[model samples]
Target: MYPLLEVHLDIIGENASKVLRLCEGKGIDVVGVTKGCSAFPEVAFVLLEAGIKILGDSRLDNIKKLRRAGVACPLMLLRIPMLSEIRELVELADMALVSEISVVKAINEEARRLGKFFKVILMIDMGDLREGIWPINLLSYLDSIRSLNYVELLGIGANFGCFGGVLPTPESVSMLINYASLAREYTLSDIPIVSVGGTVALQLLEEEK
Candidate 1:
């Protein structure tokens, strides 16, 4: 027999609920990431039942699975999108993490062609050396995005403890907050969400820093 991996759905649901409660108390919304489970509908349903209003996955195929399974909540594409996949991405995902202006333009074009509006989280690289653009270029990206009709700048996000092993510190978290503030000032939009990547960020909340 192949090595079997077992999941206790009850335990997972309990944990997710606990985390959701914690985050909600802190005025934070959690995006239940389904990538770890390959976006399996069973697990996705568990998360949804536990009050996860949004689901995130790195693969478009996974998003498709959730959609086909009748998961109706907003779906977020966690990975920076490929230009070639922009059309389907615009069709499938409600929001995405984007770093490159070219990909954003492609998404805008597709959304316009389909007569659909798309949402995106502009990613900033706060020394994580990951998928986000550097902070200095933020204004330029915002400028370009502001001109797009179909693409809406949903918020700003940053990755940590991934490629560069940069752990999330209070300073780093504050920097992300500052960027969100700057973006709002420049775009004159609310820019409500400020997302932080990596499970390690949970520590900051725990420490209440």
Candidate 2:
């Protein structure tokens, strides 16, 4: 016999579905962040069943746990990856939010060695001062990474309401969108995912800006 915390699985599932519906109605896809729940497999499954196409977790171990539990959604590392974990990150996550070019280069090298294609969302620090390339240097950074074969430039993203408590406003998000446009112009390709950070932005989704 073992001790376990009691949980209302049905309610959990209902809440997951409700949130996903709300976000989807507003033209946003939910990542179903699982780190807060310690990446519990059952809870993760509830989110998956509720139509979460992407799973976001801060820790590599949690990502590995999701895969071990047979969750099929593409996993995203919400934090900038460490060089030491590049091999596992490449093997596990479908995409990662990144800031430093050096780390991306390492990911590319590891992916090449493993014969795998890795995806990255270049994070920009839009006054939040967290993990992102400075806006001024972004285009130059894009140029440097364009020739990388095994690494796919997924899109650009930013973190707000994080360390700096910077609220993600219409203006801030617009700035991120503008950066995405610049990225597209530089690469001459459609930037696939311009991820707007945090649950706070959900409140503003209805506005047609």
Candidate 3:
């Protein structure tokens, strides 16, 4: 009885367990970015039941569906925030992966209106010529956030599969990791989330031993 599309819960369970164990006592949390199969809430439901604390997707529809399905887990949006969709995004997303200062400010304004503090991960471009700020431009964004008080700067993240395929290189990830460490050293972020999420790198990250 295989459905036309399905997510393998066993692999997900194992992957989740691995991340949890690998980051044990390392002050890291794993959120399944279910946008890969979020059109089907059942996929997210399975991951949720397995104890994934956060569920992330890029679609508003999927976010609403998961919420409507009674998912109690925190929801994070991975798409670029649209000013027009600010209210609904804020209503549905507990957190957002953001790359621009304007969007960050917009979320802050929306959150303030709603009397809420939204969590966010500031995305570093890291050679991903996509949505994030260039390295030279990132410092200003960081400095800008420090002056703002409505949104919580959760950490940092990078996407590796979009816009010129600029995010998938080791050099790119290494640069980001190094920068995050430097920022942490300067007390900007003590524990940055240098996320490497995508199927392309999965094989490399898999247990080859």
Candidate 4:
């Protein structure tokens, strides 16, 4: 048996449902993030059974594990795409949060090799100073991505708690929405995922009416 995470299952369920409700009719979807020891396939399977439409994690291995266990759902990789694991990332992930067109190029090439469409969320730094495209440079980056092979430009995302100071708020969310909207001026609508990062946003998500 594995070690327990001591996560309150009821809190998880309640949190998941609460987050989903916040996204409902907002023209966005909450991919219930399962990385906080809750990333295991069994726990994620429970969330899926409860009607969560998406599962998110930082490790491609977890996605691979879940797929191997037949716990298939719409899996999203929340980690930065490494230069090395492009092949496996392409094979296992339905989507990812990324920072560069080079990484996007790699994902697109791998998707082409596998003959599949890959969804991707461009991670914007958004004053967070973390693993994402610099906010000032993001529009150009999005424009650059428009020519890539099989990337479905999902939306923009940002890490709030990752780099020490930034926290998720209505302001941050609005900033991200605006940043993503700039891209929309160049492209079309239906940009799929706007991955607001970490548990704080998830908490605010749970706190929504």
lDDT of 2 by residue, 1-209 (tens): 89998877789889888878777776777788989887899989988887788889999999999899998789999999999999999998889988888998999999999999998999999877877888999988898778798889988999888888887888888888999998998899887788988676776764544
Candidate 1 local lDDT, residue 30: 95
Q: What is the C-alpha lDDT of each candidate?
A: 0.92, 0.87, 0.73, 0.78
Clashing pairs in 4: 154-192
What's the distance in Å from true for residue 156, model 1?
0.7
Off by over 4 Å in 1: none
**Candidate 4 on 1-209: residue-level lDDT in tens?**
99864656667677677656666745556677777764666678768766788888888777887788887677888877887988998888788888877888999888998999999888887666878887889778877788886888987888888776788888888888888777887676677556777656756655662
Q: Score every model by TM-score.
A: 0.97, 0.93, 0.82, 0.86
Provide the global lDDT of candidate 4 against the true structure: 0.78
- The C-alpha stretches of model 2 lying farther than 4 A from their native spots are 1-4, 206-209
Compare candidates 3 and 4 on TM-score and give the better one: 4
Better of 1 and 2 by TM-score: 1
- Which residue pairs does candidate 3 place in steric collision? none
Q: All candidates: CA RMSD in angstroms?
A: 0.9, 2.1, 3.4, 2.8
Worst lDDT 10-window in candidate 2? 200-209
Task: Name the runs in model 4 displaced over 4 angstroms.
Answer: 1-11, 22-28, 202-209
Ranking by TM-score: 1, 2, 4, 3
